[model samples]
Target: MRATEVAMALGEPDIHKRVEVVRTRLKRLIDKGWLAEHQRGQFSIVEGLNGAALNGAAADH
Candidate 1:
């Protein structure tokens, strides 16, 4: 999902700040090799991880 989509799903009160926070956090996950930004503003779990496992791994960060 895109940062804006995540922020909206989380129901953040501050739209602008929430998007920024989500984007930053997503970048962190990318740096940790947990996720890959395949396209601008789009992200997905890295190879070798299924959706269920990815959710657990993401929660760790």
Candidate 2:
């Protein structure tokens, strides 16, 4: 999702924080080979695979 989309979903008021949060998380996932960035502002999981994006964070539960 775009940063704006993330921000809206998260109700994050700061645009810069929204971009930073999304970019940082996406970059980490890409680096781990869990996701592939298709374009400058787009990403998806590697093909032929399915998994949750939850780390050991709040979403893990």
> Each prediction's Cα RMSD?
4.5, 5.5
- Cα deviation at 20, candidate 2, in Å, is 1.0
Candidate 1 lDDT for residue 53: 40
Question: How far in Å is the alpha carbon of 17 misplaced in model 1?
Answer: 1.2
* lDDT per model vs. reference: 0.78, 0.66
Candidate with the greatest TM-score versus the true structure: 1
Predicted model with the maximum lDDT: 1
Q: Model 2 over residues 1-61: C-alpha lDDT tens digits?
A: 6656655677777678666887787788677667677877777667754555556322222
Off by over 4 Å in 2: 52-61
lDDT of 1: 0.78
Local accuracy of candidate 1 as per-residue lDDT tens digits, 1-61: 8888877878875578778998898899798768999999998878775445454464344
TM-score for all predictions? 0.69, 0.58
Our model 1 lands, by Cα RMSD against the true structure, at 4.5
